[model samples]
Target: MSMRDQAVVVGASGIVGQAVLRAFAETPGWDAVGVSRRLPVNVPLHARHVSVDLTDRDACASVFGAMKDATHLVYAAVNEKPGLVAGWVDRDQMQLNLGMLRNVLEPLQANARGLRHVTLMQGGKAYGIHLDPNLAVPARERWPRHPHDNFYWLQEDYLRERQPHSGWHWTVLRPRLVFGDGLGSNMNPLPAIGVYAALQKARGLPLCYPGGPPRVYQAVDADLIGRACVWAARSIEARNEIFNLANGDEFVWQNVWPVIADAFGMAVGEPQQQHLAETMPPLEAQWAKIVGQHGLQAPPRFREFVGQGFAYADFQLNTGKTGPQPPSLVSTIKIRKAGFTDCMDTEDMLRRWIQRYQELRWLPPRDG
Candidate 1:
């Protein structure tokens, strides 16, 4: 709570972590650093960058030892395997993710005497949203844990059991679908949607809805998640609590399809089974052509830039082969009642981020 508090954001290159970095940079008297195996080329000048694999304990100790003055830690890093959903129940994935946090926290706890608060990012998956078709609507923080080998349970348990009794407090955030403009983020849906739209428009085709059955969903803007991180670290009421966050509204993709098509000046198409992992690899040449025609500055291998992000979008829209089920929602009342009232218009948030991708040449501009 001191004005000169310093914070370190693990997984700094990730969507949530990057947002945390920006939030800390904007604070009146906070100094922040981002930690990841690789640093983004365009990290904000006001922040410091540290490159160290959180899975490597000695490396973590070497890098974090210098941050004895750090007062806050935001752990937003994740280890995602090839199939995003399938990896949810994979024990190896769980161990890898748990190890990443342990490597960082063990070192920081030993070295940072000023460490006061720690924040962790969990998701709707914590409520069995990924593996259970019958997940209770409006998932709440107090719900009983679904019996699964989920890394969230492991990580949260570790944090609660390991935090030093006298110094630090911990909080967890469970956001549904997180949307942002991070190009290389394995979980970002924006570039996946953006590139898919650009490709469809380039081929004189409708901007199709590529995913599973039509079901309702919710999303939290990355910036909003970042704000919640800052608030949780600084507020007495938020400490030792887990809260669900979204844009404060729920939406069905079918209803928003037209809005997206219009944003790109394209026609809307019916929802279809489009597997991005199977489909995107074949579209690289076409993406290259679009890049050349538009003088865009995207990676020559578009698939590399977008990576598994598109697959994540596809999985999110239509929950794989299980067909449609009830809407997946998370109650945000806990965070709201606690006084972090920031909300985002989901449609507008998508539109703004898509336009930003165009301006940055990460995606082509809307074609006529």
Candidate 2:
């Protein structure tokens, strides 16, 4: 579809959602409508904003009912509840995602008019991770579901089952640890670390590395993810397919630690040889002091941060082999061949994020 058509974006207020809206608005021939629980704070006047809770079916139906000429529907909403088990973490997250899909699809299936593509945001968990040692690396779309994967499986199953029957085209994007712009973003771990580290530095405390740093980790900028989503929505080759999204670079946490230190203005001290739990208390105390000094809100306790941070940091995904894998990294040749050629400078992205946090007062000044 040409850029002149209308695109309806669900979860437009979120980091990724907002990025999608920004990207779509810049392209020619596209007018953007955003639907979310609340209107985004600083959207352009040309863009339309609608408020609706995805869990409320009637509200969702009302929102979809108004979009008669929409050419593309992008679902960037996700259901996430930290500290909850797989079964307990709001089946509604998956349900709301599937519900949004079905809500939009029913209209397309009935009218079969303007809908060109429906893109849903999923992540590495859909392909499973090292959580189960039994699983192998470089997980492909064809890999069997891991036993513990409940939420992603349900969503994937619904999409797979419904795509063929629905008239609208469909694509799924699996992005790894998206980091950029929205550091305090609910899903990104780096922001949490950055905030904590910044607070610690402000308090003149040491920034500690937990669990000897994760064995493997990679991240993509939110803008890059947005571009990929838009590209997938427009490209015929992207339909009915799943593609991995990352910065096309991979490194262990050790490689990233120096960057983190530099961002927080901390010395690159010797790596602490300790487990995550033992290292978190002092770091949390340091964070507390920094938060107090800056009058910023205190984050969740050290244990909570450690628990969540470990889960995110320790997980890794193979972003399919296609691009020039930098030295000492695995090949990313498969994804690059699929017309996905976006790369981001992780260090620059981190620096900008740190600056943003400071500007927003989420992080304290160095002397605070």
Best by TM-score: 1
Against the correct fold, how does model 1 do in TM-score?
Answer: 0.95
Write down the lDDT of every candidate, Cα atoms only.
0.83, 0.63
Candidate 2, residues 34-116: lDDT per residue as tens digits?
87775653465678788887777676666677677788888887655564224234566656556666665565445435677
**Model 1 global lDDT (CA atoms, 0 to 1):** 0.83
Off by over 4 Å in 1: 1-3, 319-324
Candidate 1 clash figure, as a count: 1
Cα error of candidate 1 at position 283, Å: 1.3
Best by lDDT: 1
